[model samples]
Target chain A: MKLGIDAMSGDLGSAIVVEACRSFLSKNKTDELYVVGKKEELLALESYSQVTIIDAQEVLEMTENILAIRRKKESSMVKTMMLAKNDEVDAVLSCGNTGAYYASAMLFLKRLEGIEKSCLMAMLPTYNDRGVALLDVGANSENTAEQLKSFAIMGSVYAKNVRKVSNPKVALLNIGAEHHKGDEVHQETYKLLESMQEINFIGNIEGKEILDGDVDVVVTDGFTGNVALKTIEGVAKVLVKSLKDGFMSSTRTKVGAVMAKPALKQLMNKFDTKAAGGALMIGFVKPVIKAHGSSDAIAFENAMNLAFDMVSSNVVDKMKEGLK
Target chain B: MKLGIDAMSGDLGSAIVVEACRSFLSKNKTDELYVVGKKEELLALESYSQVTIIDAQEVLEMTENILAIRRKKESSMVKTMMLAKNDEVDAVLSCGNTGAYYASAMLFLKRLEGIEKSCLMAMLPTYNDRGVALLDVGANSENTAEQLKSFAIMGSVYAKNVRKVSNPKVALLNIGAEHHKGDEVHQETYKLLESMQEINFIGNIEGKEILDGDVDVVVTDGFTGNVALKTIEGVAKVLVKSLKDGFMSSTRTKVGAVMAKPALKQLMNKFDTKAAGGALMIGFVKPVIKAHGSSDAIAFENAMNLAFDMVSSNVVDKMKEGLK
Candidate 1:
């Protein structure tokens, strides 16, 4: 399979992309790999004969107006996704400005055969050593009840393919678990989800239920989902900071931190975004994994692993079936 | 000022209420203190001769059906709010079931003169010394854009009065800080909040900005508020559990836990709901504090303190002015 990668974007830039290419190509055979970005940035990963660079003069600098990054066709992220649409590459991976990548995904790659709009999905930190997929964490905000049901179908398929959860339970995130909970859209979505036969539609899940691991996928509009996702991130940051302060408050606590290093590392890794590899914008013609913006070589390699599995999972076909 | 406190409520119902009553009544003189609830429960706080037990025979059990509780007129929580509304008591404080207390408040204490709906007032966890007030965490999921604007006014007044923050910066919670960054109602609310000259309106505050202490009051409809509030709670639980597990995992860590007890205690207190007390329902005619469901005497005492200050500050008068 040929893979297209955006090498100029993200915190680590081309350095990690080169390493990720080296690691993946060394492990398996590929037809061809197209690396997109500025020539200088792409040249860093130019060692492999099978790998080729497509330089775009306009760079989507991370520090620049990231909102305006979508207009730059020369940007590595947009060009790479464009290549995937033209079938120059089988799949696309990006660690770029997420907004730019999302815009280009819609502009070039386009949504799947039946999906009205594609969803940006990330795995949630769950209680049962299992993962839950949360959609539109910062994507579409004002979705219709039908669109929310569609999200359930896409989320179910994505969780099965990526998380390896055979029969994923899907839930709508609402104010409460009761049938009459939430506003008009949510209440209407609740009815639709409850009646849907194709998905493993669980009843409404409260905000607290997201951590319970009771459902394999939690669905909500972008507004609520984005707030929930960031709030969780903010809370995690606060908790981590508090823990760090707790461990360094005095000499005894500092020594305790030394004793608890192993456990602390394990705990950190458990909640870390790295474990999920990267977020996938599914419901496209082919798999697309958006690596974290601050990705290093390890994170890039993990994203590559995710991209590989999506290629083999036939998730697109499953999505088509669910849509049917 | 007269306060009607539910004598039998909360995790340590009578003891904590009695202690808080003992502390509060000893310092502040009021017309009369009415203790409502079971006769036996009220008798526990009889040390203050000025404290009268108004035998409330109908007990609306905590954690029971809220609809049922609303029906019980003679229940302590309901009766207390009724007493406050009828000018029989100055204010009412309950450490009982939060949902039931809110139900009782809405039904009896009622919304402020012009406010559309009363909001659940909470001091969210923050790194700053002064906490930010978040409203409508669970009171009402369905709120109009006007209700949200009113919430901003109510939240701002409470933050200023109860916390004494001068010109508290009030912000509407949305996915992003941009002008058109939200769904329909949010966009409308943003427009109103931005244009309104009645308050110190900050632009949109994202979930992460909340704990950053940039704003003193964050206003949103109950759905998003509850989701954000619960997400923080869930993440905190995850971190605390992992911390405990980390400490007990090995002999070295157990020894370290002993050494780190003081700092760990500090960390625990920071995130502990039992120590943080209860959330107040803003926009009510009478001051009502809704303690966490699992509150201990310490948390209950904290809620009592909030009520004490609410009464002393004559915060209702301030909100009355804002609403009018």
Candidate 2:
């Protein structure tokens, strides 16, 4: 398998991407990596026989507009995507501005034949030790009922192939679990999902039930999905901060925190977002993955493994079949 | 002040309501309580001079349709709302079906002039220990830009009068902080809020920032607001449960858990929803508070205190002035 990595755009510099590529190459000797970035920064990866340096002088800023993707054709992000468009790589990974990355993918790779709109799909950890696939987390600010229907099909395909879930149960995320809940778009999407035979449709799931591990795939518009996902992250951060402050208030609790270090570390790992690697941009002709902006070496390596798994499992091909 | 309580509709039964009334009336001798429910169940309150046991044989089920408010006029929820409508009580409180309670409040007390729709407003805990008022939590499944404008006015008045903020900073709850983000309704609402000189408009706030205590009031359509509120609660529950399981995994961790109990308890109290009392049904002529369905005596009493505070603060009059 061959992969293209945009080494300059992440919050952490290209040095970590170099380190991740080295670690990944150490494990998978059969895979080829095309590391795209400034020549001087990525020169460290040249020692590995399986790694090739693809020089792109420009770097996209984190707050760059989506239109910047069209203007900055020589940037690493656009160059990496162009490789996927040309069939030079099976998949491409970047941790750049999400809006810019998505726009670049649409411009270079285009959408699948039967897909109306492309979406970002991420795997979230659940209490049952399994991950649930959530789609349209931030692809489009708004979506039509037909667009949400396409997201369901794409999400189900991802769960089946990449996550290895058989006959995934897809649900609409709304305010209530009842059939007659949510707005006009959601109500119409419910009918579309219920009538389709391509996926196993669960009636509806609320935001609170997303992490309960009851459903394999949850679908919603990008606006609501983005807000809900971030709200969970925000609450977790607040809780962890509060706990740290409480533990340090007195010597007795400080000693207890020392003894509970291992257990707490295990618990943090259980809820870690890094374990899920990164979000996949589905409904495109070629696979595109978006690593978290703050990814370190280990997280970036996990994202690379995800790209390899998607290509090996033929996820995009299966998605095309599901859409048809 | 006179307060009406719906004793039969809560999930915890009338016993907790009775206990709450006793505890409330013990300190608030000047306030009158008109507890409406099955007379036999509420006979314990008859001994107090401040308590009046009003009989209503029927109980509204939690899953009952909103139209049941019209059909079940003799039910405790309707009777309690009727007391407020007749000016026999200054305010009403219920721990009942949210839909039925809102429907009954609209049917009985009616919306204040210039108010297009009534909405549920909730007080959420923030990291800074102050509270933020979130409006349209679950009143209308969908809303128009104009309706959201009304929600902003009502929520601002609530923050000023009920929450006691001097000059409230009002923001529209959205997926992004940008001026051009979100769907059509939110974009229109942003313009409306920006043009209005009455509110201290602070542009848009995302779900993650709702608990940061930077804004005093956040307004949105009911569907998104409900989903966001519940998502915060869900994540908090999952984290607490995981912490419990981790601490119980081994002997050393169990010892640490014993020493960490006080700190953990303090953290829990800091994030507790019960301290906010309950959600107020705003945009009506009178105040209508809905307690959590599973409220115990302490939570129910907090809701009662909320009712007392709203009536005493002349929140309804100020809301009418703000709307004008």
Candidate 3:
């Protein structure tokens, strides 16, 4: 399978993306990579014989607005999106401005049939190795009932085909588990989701139960999902920092920290966002993965692996079948 | 100061409430307490000379509907609300059904003049000893612009007078920190908050910033606040559990666990919800504190101490003056 990488889009310099592509190509020697970036920088880097370089003049900054996507057609990110649009590659990946990346994909790749909006799905770590897929983390802040139901259908297909969860129990994220709880949009969406027979629709799940690993997929509008996702991120960050401070408060504690370093590091790594790769924008013609802007080479390579998995599973075709 | 406690409302039963009151009385002998509960059960427990038992024949379960507050007039929770309404006690405390408790307070205590709604303010653990007070966790799921503005005022006063933050920095909770982010209500509320001179109105704060200790008060509508608060709670719980399982993986790790027990325990306790005390229901004629349902005797004592502090600070009166 072939993949395209937006080397100039990440917060880290394009060198890291080139390094990641080189590493992935070394492992799967037959697979081809199109590294899209400025020509001079791409040529300056030590090249892999199997990897191809695609040149563009402009680079999209992280602070750029969504309008930049429309204006800067010669930008490297937009060029990468066009490659996927023309089926030049099986998938495309980026770590750029999220809004611009999303807007670029919507403009070039287009949405699938019967899908009103595409969603960003993140794999949230749970108790065991199995994690749950949470959708629309920040794709569309405002959504109607019909849009939400479409998200549920799209999320279920992704979970089943990509994550390999059978019958993928899909749940609506609500403040309360009761069917009548939440606002009018949620109440109406609950009824719509309940009527759908194509997916395994569980009732409403509360925010506290999101990490319990009971459900395979959780669906919500962009606002609540974004808040919930960031809340988890914030708490984990604070907790780890506080724990480190506590362990360094005294000499005995410092000694203990050395002994506990391996176990504690293992525990902390489980909550690391990079381990989950990037969020995938499903319901598109080709899989588009959004890696974290601050991701290192390892994370970018993980995103490439995720893109390969999506292509191999034929996830878009499965979603098209299910939506129909 | 005289305080009231719903002894029958907590999950630990009247015994823990009685013990907590005993502990509080032992610290402050002059203060009096009225323990509201079933007559027979109250008499069955060992009594203190300073404690007086108020007869209440009914008990409200956690699953009961909000209408149960009106139906069960003789319930222990409602009886405690009536005690505050009649000015028989300076403050009221309960660890009962949250919805029913909220409904009971709204029914009997009514809103303070100039206040449209009451909010639940929870003190979240941050990096340092200092914490931020987040409001409207589950009170008004749907709030008007005026109501959100009111919540900001009430939260600031509570932080300054009760939490002793001097001039507390109040922020509107949104998905993004930018000016034009979030939905319509948040956009309008941002403009309203910016115009208010009474509050130390910093602009918007995202969910990830809640525990960073940068802001003193974070305010949002109930829906977003509740989801964010619960998401924090869920993440903390899962992280601790996962760490424990990681520590027990091998014998070498078990030795490391023993050495790290002290520092790890101290770090975990920093995130404990009990250490922060119960959530306060503000914008009332009197302070109504809701302790966690599964609170131990120590947590209950902390809630009692919170009530004493609120009464001593004359929080309600100061809020009344600020609103006027």
Candidate 4:
């Protein structure tokens, strides 16, 4: 297996991607990884001799127009995606701006057969000590009922094959759990899911139910998912701040904070971006993983590993089958 | 001003309503308090001697048929709302089932003119050490673009009058802040808001930007708001749990939890539902406060004080002028 890595995409420049690729290459030989970026940056990696380097001089700035994905063929991110598009690589990974990667994935790589729209899938931790694989987190915020049902099918395949959750309970995330609840699109989608036999369709799951581990695959349009994803992040920040303030309110508590630093740091790390790789865009022929732009080496490594597993699992095959 | 409180509502029954009313009567000469519920229950209040008793024989059981709000006219919640409609009371307070309260409010108190939909507004703490007010939390999971605009208007007015901010900044929540970013509805809504000269519309706001305190009013449809709201709740719960677990992980940390107990308790109390009181449904001609179903005495008192402020500030009068 071969993989394409856009080693120029994250907010940390080459530090994260270079180190992650170098560290990851140390452990793996079954996969031939191609690092696509500036030739100078590629040479900086001691692991450059161990793997292939595709010199793409184009720089895709984070704040650049998303259409740059099309305009900049020599761009590392775009070229990396192109490698997978032409089947030169099995997967492509990026820690770049999500919109740019998304643009290139569809514009260059194209969607898999039988998939109407690709979804940005995220693995969100559950309150129940598990994970719910969700779709369209920021890809297609506005969706028809048919598009939603399609998302459910795509999400289920990804969860079962990659996440390895058998029978992967699929649910449409709605405002309410009742079959009759939600907007017109959701209500109609509920009816469609209720009639479908291809996936293990569960009833509507509410946002409050996401972390509850009620469903393995939660489907929603991108807008709600993005807002929800951000809201979760925002609230987490608030709570953590509250906790920090709580721990340092007085002299004794400040001392307590010192004694508890290790454990508290460990807990806070769980919410760190580096621990959870960026979202995955599902329903593509080649596995495409996105590391958070603010990701550290751990996140970049995590994205590569996640992409490795995704490509190996043949999740796309199931998606194609389910699409039919 | 006359206020009717459902004595049977709330987790902690008539005692809170009695105390709040007792406090109200003692402080003001131009006040009438009506305890609307089972007379037998009202008798449980020590301060019951100062209030009028209106018999409402029926009770809408929580977690049961939510439509029971419409079915039982004699129910305590329905009676109180009807009292508000008939001018028998200036406002109605309930700590009962939310669905039941909504049904009664729509059936009896009626919608304010030019206000086709009402919203559940909550004050969320911002990263900047201030609060940002968001509306349509879950009142109507599905809403028209016009209704969303109305929420923005109402939210702005409420923030100005109740929160005492001038020239309140208003923003339409979207997947992106860019023009024409989201689906059909949001694109159109964006145009509509941008054209509304009367509103201090600052353009679109993404979810992560919510707690930045850049905008005073964040308006979105209830479905998304509800989802975001619950997601925030879920994340907060997880973070708090993680913090607690972190503190208890080591023996030294276990001792820290005790030393940190006082400050932690104070911080937790600040985040308590009691401090915030219940969700407030703004846009009524008079203040209609919804105390939490599980509210304790402290929470009930908080709701009552909020209600007093709502009236004293005359949020209705301001809405009447701004909305028109």
Proportion of native contacts in model 1? 0.62
- Cand 4, B chain, TM: 0.90
Every candidate's DockQ is 0.69, 0.76, 0.69, 0.64
After superposition, candidate 3 runs with Cα above 4 Å error: A29-31, A43-50, A70-72, B39-50, B63-67
Q: How accurate locally, in lDDT, is each candidate? A: 0.80, 0.90, 0.87, 0.79
Chain A: TM-score in each model: 0.94, 0.96, 0.94, 0.93
Record all residue pairs in model 2 with backbone atoms less than 3 Å apart, i.e. clashing: none
As for candidate 3, its clashing pairs are none
TM-score of chain B of 2: 0.96
- Over B68-125, each residue of candidate 1 has an lDDT whose tens digit, in order, gives 7657877777877778879887777787877888777777666778887888878876
Ranking by lDDT: 2, 3, 1, 4
Q: Which regions of candidate 2 are displaced past 4 Å? A: B63-67
Best by lDDT: 2
> Which model scores highest in DockQ?
2
What shift in Å separates residue A176 of candidate 1 from its native position after superposition? 1.6
Instruction: Please state every model's RMSD to the true fold in angstroms.
Output: 1.9, 1.5, 2.2, 2.2
> Can you write out model 2's per-residue Cα lDDT over B229-277, one digit (the tens) per residue?
9888888888888888899999999999888777788789889887789
Evaluated with TM-score, which candidate comes out highest?
A: 2
Candidate 2 positional error at B316, Å = 1.0
Error of 3 at A53 (Å): 1.1
